[model samples]
Target: MMDYVWFIRWFGPSDIYSTQLGELAHRVVKKLYGLGNKKRDPRQIGRRLRRVEWAKRAFDRRGIHTKRRRQQAVANKDDSITTHYHIGKSNKKRLDLKTYTHSRDPAAKGFWTKLQDHILGRLMQHEFDGDTHETFTDDDRKHIRIKDRKLVELQTLRVNYTTYDIRRDQDTINPRNHADVMMLSPEDEPGAHPYWYARVLRIFRVQVISTHPLASTVLSGPQEMEILWVRWLGVEPGYHSGFQRGRLPKVGFVDEADPFAFGFLAPAHIIRGCHLMPSFSDGRTAGLLQTSEPTAARKTDEIDDWQFFYVGIFVDRDMFMRYFPGGGVGHTANQGFFQSTPDNAENEPRGEESGDEEDELESDSEMHQTTMPPSQAQAEQPFAIDSDESVDGESSHDSDESFDSDPEGDDDLNETDVDDWQWDDGYGSA
Candidate 1:
């Protein structure tokens, strides 16, 4: 007889017990005839017990206990453990198994949904607003990444002609001057013309240390160039009477220097001597002469000859050495003369009077002529006069009767007297 407790210990539950009973029967021999007394030999029985123990040990080592396996088998025996739960809706309004599991897990659902919404929102905003997603264009991005790139490039640009000053010792060493060339046109003129007589009053050479856009390149360095002074000249009658005959009763130097300033010793004086007498002729007439064709032909008797002349003073080195023996820069014979008026000429020895001793010294030394070529000599011949008698006639007869009248006739002169006196006497008489 099987001990029930032993059977329960060996086999596990009712279901396993039935299966084990069947398997045990298959392996048992029928010779177990007299169950009580016909027991097998102790050694054989021991061997069988040992075999069962080894089998139990093997099963234990594999972590497969009959009780737990029975419980698992029973639990999974039917479809009862395989339960279903609803999740998010699918295309057909039915819950998808994978998505249902994911949706049921709140953590996973929140993460995925938030990420999806953010991506979709960004895409929509890009499409609707037409915003650029890239910071740089394709070409620009590649250009920035290139290893060899120039930091700056050279280019040509336009600039205006302008002027600047150079001064020393509180004195304008180089006074108002002009750039060599500038283009100008009158309001009505069709094209620009070069004004040649526009004097360059001073010049400088400077390096263009730096620049802003519109500055001229002509002044870009410490280099020399001429500048011009722009001003008008005032002509007064009787100022030029002694030099060019009374015919030039009016005169002016269009380009004049302040008598008080230390001007360019040579050029300034030349300009001062070349007095300009404005022609009463129309500017249109003068402009016609500048054109290619002339309106009139000259008679055989009419000569086209014209004369040009210039006069300039040159100071010899000896003169400069005598006055400035130490040989300093900017030595000028007329420098002292500029400090005082001509009326005070006797007040001081005008820059050390040229002495005979100095002349002798210069003669001993190699003397050199400092004067410019004689071709520049101005024709200064005295004005041609028919006679001294004509001069007297012009002067005496042309005098106003007022000069000869007594104090009694001052109020009696009428409009006729004024008209009669208008032809000529001297300045303002006509």
Candidate 2:
């Protein structure tokens, strides 16, 4: 009946009518009947129904949107001053900073030190209050406060972002499972790659309390701070990759000495979670960090990172849109980049939508227009914030979290329909 969707305009819109709709009412009425004495139960049911309606009306009048139904977390591009995100309805667990066994919790490895450095970063480094990358002096670090050490681990990160088509949408991100994340590249010339990529090692919330004179305004007392401990991956130094090349962006673990190899990040800095499939042919090696001194960032038993991974842009329409920028990945007034420069315009083919890509966009766009999934709607508002910052590990975040593979709802979005990032005989000039 999907083909009949065009008739919706002609016949007027209608909900799916079925016997189950009518039948479900009886289940509720029976439930109410069972709760009271059978005598005059019909009257009781009617009274209960009226009470429910009255309560709903009261809620509407007071604008009391319950948290359970407050699902429109995707703010529109025009309204969003800060990134909007949610964690769905999963329960969160907090852990103490120590196992009392000489800080041997591989997961929480470097938790205390990294977190302490993070406090210093927040106080000195982060771009808070219109400041750029500045750090506290040795004297300043002495005055910086660090109190609570408990870490709150979240299960999911529902990142609400604006679709390229100027509509709001979101992706559910989980560190244990859906761990890959993407953000706008800090690079100037993005002809090769336009976004930064990272594999989230863990998601945490820290309650920061500072008594330092420098942190009086920002850390007045105590505040809940959300951060992601991520291992940063870099685009292959000279690998020419993009859909324009009929290939995905080739990325790999950066050198251990790179400041961004690992870091803590403020949640708002992320654009959205991404799909990154391993470049199996390239193989994995423990040498990225070291096999001898296994990093706590990896699983307890593992000491390797995928030598390389391919950006799976074709995983979904939104993801495809993000890479195929001209496909409309939330660029208003041609601002957020999706076009090549005049030098590479012909080589890159600006705004050139291949027939197949165009068809996919049209089909997805049509589906979008026809089906109004209740989960998504024209959001009434987007997120706003005064200040946000990236706590790029500048130092390795290799110091934290016990690695437990929580494989809940692992997404098998990989489709063999797309070609893999093929093997290249050699590398280009560095």
Candidate 3:
């Protein structure tokens, strides 16, 4: 056999050949033991040996004489190639670092403050004059005039008034000459001309006692005041049929009823002492709360006639105070005429009694006409519906509780006696 001394020397246990020495040991042991031989040509084996030697020499030149160093050199080359390939393929670039920036101007904070001041200054000077800040009153002729004028503006539009008979207790489409009906008008109509328009604010059946003097009172008046149901018609284009009239321009005939006829049917008594004029607007017009004397005086007569004919409609303020007594007017902040009474007490009437004690007592007695007798009051009081005997029997059954005890003698025992009992008998026997 040819001497293979260099091959064995090269695969020896020195640091330079440690890995190859392990592989050679495996092959030699397998062959000697008759396990098998690795099938590799001499040329291929020489190529693998050359690669290992080159790695070992490179490691040694760097003062890395250990087996670990040689392996590390080979691994390092692989890592370097991977990192270079990734860098060459990618298009990533480093970004510039940034610092935060802030504004130091004082004017930014003051912008809104300046705007508010300007607006408030203009509002104070142009609108709320000193006298304008004073409280308004229903009794104030100026205020009433303004209210009437505004009402006239609202009433210029066409509206409908339907009559409901209290006597019949049902609605009648075609009202009889003297029959009553409910009426309605809108509070505000969108996109309409800003002028006096006809609106059926209320409807109540008032007896036509005399058309000549035009004198009449609310059918159920003073004591049992009737509620005049009002329907506010908004400003919209529409017509009023037979017994109906269009706008004021369409009122061609003498005493010809407008579509909304309550304004023409009103009797004098209801509106005699009351002020009727345009006092306020829906704020759609400039100077909404302003009062005009001439316009109000003229409209007073017109509205008075219209209101008298239209089932004697009253303004909200007048109606509230008249019917509701202490009910507050305009805004709830305004004090009401009536004060609340305690549960057990009666609400004393507000005005002074016109007659003597007997008359006052009679008035008080009249107020109780709708009240029931004391016997009825007692009967209405709540009490148990069942008999006293049945209640007593149920209570007795609930009170009984005496039949629940164990009969066994073993139920009670001293703690020491129980503890002395044997528990390990089965285990000990086993």
Candidate 4:
């Protein structure tokens, strides 16, 4: 029964053809047998019958299999390339940078930029300030000192690095070791602290002048920093956009004021390049997406090494319909559950009985008019009633015999009336 609905969608009219073909097979089998060989032994007959059954089964199965193969081939050939692809979840190979770089069918490019323009209300400013140096190439800037005895040793070559290396270097269980916090210092904070945190979705190592805003004006030396594009973590709770870290600490008098919504962007120091793990979550912390143990990620040791990056910008079919141009007006107008049907004058299709209703009413009224005599019809009219006279007595048509014959005349019986009181011959009170 469950498969009935599934089959209807997949096969459509195939069942009809199948039934017809089956009937033909049955007829052919019947004609070939005719009373089945009367001279054959019992064991021979049984074997022969089994062979026939096997042939029938094989025929049906082969037909079904061929039909299915043709359907699949047609689907593969005819499906449109322009259909909006859902990028929510995919295998590691699909999301990998190396695989993506080689493929002719590219994933949606400029997603981060478009998302920034749409949600953040401004584009990312391209400032040329040189403050970075390659540790492997330049001996003067091998290690960058961070806050609380933390230091970033830039030993990995940017050119040879894969997506896996970037993610492994950034993401971590310890909050201190997180890429976003690597450049942060206790003194820098309480002065000009970074309010938002983001995972480095992408990084560009192109040459650019990344000078310190204040120090550049005073001194002549210019430094460079690697340009990083990041997907911001949301400050608001319950938005399905980003992975949930723990709740922010209460900072003010209000005990329950939620953290500020933090996905908006401007020119800020990007001290992190990290992977966003796609997972389910509790209200506070990140959780596993799978309900069963040994997730697909954990099933293979290689999967654990593969990194992923995702922002909740991609829209599904339903979400696209909501914000689609000119569609919202009609959607809002017809938002209610009630649907208004157009008038019959507009030539909408009606049931057979529905159109006959007016004709039936008119015919019944004409029959009623003809059944009554002219005098009776006239007496029943509203103008026939006299204004000053009372007409309470019985009409001329009311006869004693006619009254006695009426079944409802029994309702007029009253033993308490003096005129109606009568005695039976044998009973005194009758």
What is the TM-score (0 to 1) of candidate 3?
Answer: 0.16
What TM-score do all the candidates reach, one by one?
A: 0.14, 0.54, 0.16, 0.18
lDDT per residue, candidate 1, 96-203, as tens digits?
Answer: 223422443221223222222222223233331111223323332221110121111111111211111111111011121111111121222221111112222222
Tens digit per residue, CA lDDT, model 3, 201-236: 322221111111122223422111111211121222
The digit string of per-residue lDDT tens for model 2 on 164-231 reads: 44567667676656778887665555354567777777667666766567565353567656778777
Residue range with the least summed lDDT across 10 consecutive positions in model 2: 403-412
Task: Give candidate 3's error at residue 63 in angstroms.
Answer: 99
Best by lDDT: 2
- Which residue pairs overlap in candidate 2's backbone? 75-382, 107-401, 107-402, 109-399, 164-328, 164-329, 164-330, 263-393
Candidate 4, residue 339: CA error in Å? 52
Model with the higher TM-score, candidate 2 or 3: 2
On TM-score, the stronger of 3 and 4 is: 4
The true-versus-predicted C-alpha distance at residue 294 of model 2, in Å, is 6.6
lDDT of each: 0.24, 0.56, 0.24, 0.27
Q: Which 10 successive residues of model 4 have the least lDDT summed?
A: 401-410
